[model samples]
Structure formats: structure tokens, C-alpha cells
Target: MLTIIPDLPDHIFGLRASGEVTKDDLQQVLLPGLEKLSEQYKEIYYLLVLETDVRNFTAGAWVQDLIAGIKHLTEWKKMAIVTDQKAVEKFTDIFSYLSPGEAKGYKLTELPIAIGWLSHKA
Candidate 1:
């Protein structure tokens, strides 16, 4: 499931994911939430925390994520992905190079630092 990460500034959009995050979660929760935030701001800071229990994404969910990302390609101002999973870390690292804004991956133990980094303005 996905839930907002609380206590962030207005321009920051954060979410914590655990368990099996399905296409419905992206459609019903994440994408719509980002869409709404996009309407409210020109640029958005994003924080995604994939807790250790998170399972693999469904095929459709991956497609949705790609679509949403392309739709808001320039909307991201900063992004931090917190996880200990190697594949996820590698993917985030690669995606970072293609992002318009700064993107970084942090170890699960560095979640606090990741939040702090995203919270700061570039």
C-alpha cells in the first residue's frame, strides 16, 4: 500500500510503500496525488520510501509509473528514493541521470538523511 509521508513542506510530495504495490495503488493513490500536486505547483520535490517489506511491482503498475513519469517529466525538482534493495538502488541511480532535477538513492538506514536532502532547496 501507499501513504503520504507527513510533516513535509507544501512543495514536497512524499509516499511510503510497503507490501505488494499494485497497479490500482498507482492509479488510485500515487499518480492522482501527484497529478493534483502538479496542478498546485510548477515543480515538486518527491520522496519515495520503499520499506523492506515491499514486494515486486506488477507489470501494469510499472507501466503506469512510466506513463506518469513521462507526463510530469519536468515537474520534478528533487527526488530521493530510500531503500536497501540492490535492484531498486541500481534502477534509481540510473534513472537519476536522466532526471531533470537531482535524484539520489539512500540506504534504508539513511532515510532521515534522504528526507533532509530533499527538504533543502537547490
Candidate 2:
């Protein structure tokens, strides 16, 4: 399941995921939400909190993720992935170099720090 992260500032687009997140979640919930958020904020400050493992996502979901990412390629500002897995964290950190904007991963314990970092303007 995917749901919006509440109580965030206008500049941030945040979501929390648990269990199995499917393509429908992205096509229906995630993509439209980003489109709306991006209309108001040129740069997308994304925060995704994963309560379940990344392996839980279906194959179609991964495709939709890529599509959603590419749809807003130039508008990315900061992406903070909140997951407990160290490998995922390291991957996000390394991939940040190839991305137009910053990307980082944090443990659930560092969620507050992640949000704070994204909240600040560069």
C-alpha cells in the first residue's frame, strides 16, 4: 500500500509505503500526486518511507517507478528514501551522483534528519 506522508510543507512530496506496492498505486496514487505537487513546486522534494522490503514490489511496479521518475527527470530536487536496509542506503547514496538532484537514504531512525535536510533549500 502507498499513502501520502502528512503534515509536510508545500515544497515536499512525500509518501509512505508498506506491504505490496503495485503499479496501480503508482499510476493511480503516486503519479497523479506528483503531477499535482509539481505544478505548484517546480523542484520535487520526494520522501519515500518503506515499511516493507524493496523486494516486495512487483515487476510492473518497478516499471511504473521508472516511468514516474523519467516523467519528471529535470524537476528532481532531493529524494530521501527511508529504509532500514544498508545496501539500499548505500545504493541511493552512490546513485545520487548520476542524478540531477541529490538522493540519499536513511534508516527509520534518521527519518527526522532526512526530512530536515530536504526541507532546507539548496
What CA root-mean-square deviation does each model show from the true structure?
1.6, 0.8
Where model 1 places Cα greater than 4 Å from the true spot, the runs are 52-55
Best by lDDT: 2
lDDT for model 1 comes to: 0.84
Candidate 2 per-residue lDDT, tens place, 44-122, comes to: 8999998888998889899999998998999998999999988889999998999999999999999999999999966
* Model 2's TM-score against the true structure: 0.96
Question: Model 1, range 23-78, lDDT digits (tens) per residue?
Answer: 99899988977888899987778899998444567888788988988899988888
Local distance difference test values of all predictions, in order? 0.84, 0.90
TM-score to native of every candidate shown: 0.90, 0.96
Output the lDDT of residue 79, model 1.
Answer: 87
Global lDDT for candidate 2? 0.90
> What's the CA RMSD of model 2 in angstroms?
0.8
